[model samples]
Target: MNRKLLVLPAVMGLAAPVLAGCGDSNAGSGGGDSIVIGTTDHIAVSKELPSPVDPATSYDGGTYTFFNNTFQMLLGYERSATIPSPDAAKSCEFSDTKSETYRCTLRDGLTFSNGHALTSEDVKFSIDRVIKIKSDYGPVSLLSNIQSVEAPDDKTVVFHLKASDATFPYKLATPAAAIVDSEVYPADKPLDGLQMVGSGPYKLDSWDGDKAVLSANPNYKGLVGKLNNSKVEVRFFETAADMEKALADGGIDMVNRTFTSDQIAGIQQGKEPNIKLTEASSPSVRYMFFNVDDPTVKDKAVREAIARLVDRDALTRDVTHRTATPLFGAVPTGIVGHSNAYFNTYGQPSRDKAAGALSAAGISTPVKLTFSYPTDRPATPNKEEAVALQKQLNGSGLFDVTLKGMPWKKFLPGAVKGQWAMYDLSWLPDFPDPDTYIAPFFAEGFLNLNYPGGDIKNSLLPSTRQTADRGQTDKDFLQMQDILARDLPVIPLYQDKQYVTTRDNITGAEWLLNSSSTAQFWELGRGVAG
Candidate 1:
């Protein structure tokens, strides 16, 4: 699976589809009133209805909210490099050492809110639906390796993978693997309403176009410990500033997702006794991927030249403001099997060396190129960062750079289709593993949207995946890095940091910033005023 991005589709003017086959329940002691949680997202929860609901498509924050309320995955992650935990399934394991076949035992009393027993048929149906409906709505490659899902009984589910993969269990833990009801969902087309049918701790209570109401599920069999609260209301807004204002006015209980480092710092430094901020390491890495299809970028010498020209230090310090660290390799730290492969081979960008490479290629004319990025997602400083990136390349004199941009909803699909010569991009880890970083873009796998020739297109990456040995995978990855360093198709930029703000009245909030960036809604409660 490709690393997750910020996924600012709502701000980018793309209307995400509403989620179906999920529900919520009531449990909080806070009466019938709801606590609003604000976010700068312009999502349309549902169409042909006046109430706001969960969007079927994956947008960063909404995914967590939707899953907490109505959906369930077989497994889940609480931190980086951690094993998947049983969610809907009572226990899960691979049947053999080959890691090709996985089996899960559902909890004995698992049932949808409607009282229908959750079965292997629903698991088979949900897994198959994602593959068949493959829409731009979300990344489908999350389930690309599965040959088929089999269920021999009502409580047992089995998955047969196309090849030997140790990480198959982690894939099943993601929201893309969310289990759905076979009865209410249509097999032919995507569902188009706000209603959901799920078996989670919380269920949907009400909707108001841009706001959602949630309550605890009384039938949930997976209650870990005593939950902190019973009700949560999530609100969507048009900008971060608006969300911040709502927080200041006590219009919301918490602020989640996509706050910059400085914004996070501000909350930490504030004198407001009621406000609290939480910080944690995110497994995600942000970097630029090159359009290797372009004639200029396709050249190994030019690609390496561009890599040598970029000032990753400046980009991280001035643009990102130390919120993120410079990425010396494709895979970031925390992800297993990651190394500083690129830095070990290429060292750092060098003007003289870059100039020499250009001369050795017999190129006297300045190379002309353009870079694109999303406008609405990261706010204004990112624009400055793009300009800095542009200046660095253009200053090399061997290159003439033009800067271009659009909203993320538009930019993402275009970048995926190899439509731009060069652009700034970021990848959030779909799962916390080195494989999450390397395989999707370089391994010639399903999400390698631009890489043709299957795995053979890049000679080195294929060698790594072809082997079943972990040591061999590491060796093959090292060789692949060498090839990429020499070719410089994409420059390793920075691994981003995730920040969250909370009121002092909030407890158990640290669990929210995990590898999946998901929090158990039941774990939250009011803390003493700071």
Candidate 2:
């Protein structure tokens, strides 16, 4: 799914020191009270909402905001922790040394929001439905290793895997593993539209075109603990500027997602006295994808030459204002098993090395290549970044570059159709793991709709996925990274940090930075005196 960005005009100024102030007196604070959280994420209407908001079929950041809050998984990552812990399950563990068999005991007295009993049968049904439905966009791939699911009784559920997978628990924490109400939801097909009967901390009160109202589930007793606010109103905005204005006018209490760099710089400069900023290094990364079918990039040496010429430091410092980290590998920093394979392979930006690569391939200077990027992604100024990228490659005098831009909707499909020789795109992980980074781009044909070829698809990817040991998994990934450094199917440009702005009196803002990188509404409260 394309993470949409808001495009904003360049506003130049030095950032002033931030000054923390008290919460706005006129605004309703989220201190066990109701508050509106504004975001630029497009909220689909009841009819337009993806099928059932069902975990089996729904996949996207915009939809997960609803799924994560409404549904509970058997295992979920603790706040700021990478390891998965029990949520719906009282306890869970692999029963065999091979990690092929897993057993979980459900928490007693569990009930869905609709008051239906939640048990092992429902858990079995949930996992089975995901595999049976096998929607192309669905998360069936996450459970590919799962051979069968069994429920011996009301409390005990067991999973038999075809192979050992150490990351299985982490996968259980994803929205794809959200336990559904077997009685309310069908087993054969996806349920239709915003209709949900979940067992999470909150239940859907109402959902309209502009906003979604969530009320804390009184029957809920899960691992999320107590929610500070009783009700949460999520308001959607079409533009970053509109959302910022609403935040300024006290129309909303907090703003997240798709903030322009200029807006972030403004917030950092204390431009809005009522707004406070919180920062965390995100697992999101941006990279350039090449269509191997294209004659220009088919040669591995040509790809290597281009990779050597890229200047990530300049891209982050000049365009992103140091808001992003210069990424040297597919896996972004802050995640386990991340390695700077690109940096190790191509130490620094050097024109001589790039030229040498081209020379060895019997290619001449002034290589002609066209670069494509989206015009609407405002978070990092994709267009501006593409321009900077073009300048960097052309400056080496080894290539002639042409730049093109389109809206993300068209650009994504066009890139998939092999319409662009080279295109730039960014990825926010479906789950926080190096596998999420590697598997999507390199392993399968997920992005290979147009170009049906990837270098490591057969070699390192399958080996990496099959490995059960964390230590061996890391080694396989590092080896994969080295292969990627040489093959250059995609060039990792940079990784970005997440920024959320709230009123100074808002407490628990830091807790929003969780494993999934989704906002944790339960962790936020306001009206606390500063």
Candidate 3:
């Protein structure tokens, strides 16, 4: 659900609305202090979103954060853990050795927000709607293995797959496979607007276009675990400055994203007495992709040449101020199947090497191409990242590059249609696995490079997905990473480090993000109650 860019009003610079009708002003330690989180990460990368709340079409991280708390699934990722734990289901497993029939049993006495039964039928309806709609902005690809679904009983749901896939549970653990209320959500269409009705940990109390208020759902009977703060609010800020100011002014209890380098440095140096910072090696990765269908980049040598000239270390150090680290492959470090394939093959940036590769392929010097990036992600440094990228490639004197920035609405669709010759995009895994890093970009190309992934998709990907033991498939992933490096369809720029800064008194800040870097607002607490 990433490439979680930015939403319309949020991207268009909507001001963060203050909390309404709240009695507590204490943002620090104390019982009943309502936890408020501030961030500039309210980005959604959807095309047909009349409202960016539908689980089917809303495939961005910001929306996924919202979905995780409101809509329950059969399985969910444990905090900082990859293995799926039971959520709505009391038990879930493949019924046959073929790994084709996935079955789950709902917990007893489950019900929706309106007291309607939360049955296997609702689960079947929700998943079927996603498949039938097949929105370009949705996670339809993740569930492509499903041949059909059945509600054998009110409490039991069965999924029949087109092929044997042991990783089915991992895919289902994500919010993409969210279970919605059949009575509320339309069968053939997405539920329009931000109206949420599901059985999860939190209920959407109110959304004033900027801040969304969430309260503990009394009807929720899932695996969301214990709630630290019973009530929480997610406040979207227009800029990093606004977010930091809100945190400093006690308007919010924590800051999730877009903090300036100076602010981060100051906090790390212990300059802020009231602040506490928690960080982790992040799974989020950003890279440059080439549309192989584009005539300018059709040649493999041309693609490989650009990869050689990219200065990743400088991009991370100067632009992001080393908040991020240079990445050599699609899968980041700490993940199971990570490899330094690009670094192994191309080494560091070299103008001579790039030029030599191009000349050897009989491609003329001073190749002309357009480098595209998104302008809609105002909260992020898209422009700076793009300008720096252009300098790396064009300043080589072997290429003449023109820089272009389009809003995400126009940019994403064009990218999916294979319109851009070269563009920069960011990614966070739909699930914490190597296939997430490789397959989405390769199989028909999520960046829609219009390149049939050839061996990677046809051979390697299917082979890797055949087993549940993710560690055993490292060899296949290693080869896939090698092929990506050899072909040079995309170049990995950097992987970010997750940072969540909260008031010193706030507890459980480290558990704010799960294994996939999805936000878990339920983890934060202020003080123990009587």
Best by TM-score: 3
What is the lDDT, from 0 to 100, of the residue 45 in candidate 2? Answer: 33
Candidate 3 lDDT over residue span 264-378, tens digit each: 8778998777988776667788888888878999998899898899888999887778878999987777776688999999998899999999999999989999988888564
Give the range of the ten consecutive residues with the poorest summed lDDT in model 2: 4-13
Please, what are the lDDT tens digits per residue for candidate 1 over residues 1-530? 11121221111111111112122222333233444566654445333222222223452444545664577777654333255667677677777666677888876667876677788888888888877876544546667778998999988899998876666666777767877778877654456656777777677777666887777766665523344567787787777767776777788877765555556556767834577666566666667777776775766778777777777788878877787888877766654345676777667888888888888988765887787877877432557778998888888778888888787666766765677777766566655445666666665342323545333244554343334333335555555555556556667888776665666656656654445555556655665111
TM-score between candidate 1 and the true structure? 0.84
Q: Which ranges in model 2 have alpha carbons more than 4 Å from their true place?
A: 1-31, 45-52, 363-370, 375-380, 394-421, 449-473, 527-530
Residue 68 CA displacement from its true place in model 3, Å? 0.8
Clashes of 1: 17
User: Per-model C-alpha lDDT, please?
Assistant: 0.63, 0.74, 0.78
| Cα TM-score per model | 0.84, 0.85, 0.91
List of clashing residue pairs for candidate 2: 52-193
lDDT of 2 by residue, 1-530 (tens): 32211111121111111111121111122346676888766645343335737888766676676777888888765566555678888778888776678888888788999999999999999999998987655677778779999999999989999776666776887888889999988898888766778888888898786888988887776677667777889898878899899888888888766677778888999899888888766777788899887877787788888888899889888888877889998876655567899999998998999999999999987999988887764444878888898899899998898998887656755765567888777777766567788876665445652433354566566665455544356666777788878777888998876777787667766776566676667777775422
Mind sharing the TM-score for model 2?
0.85
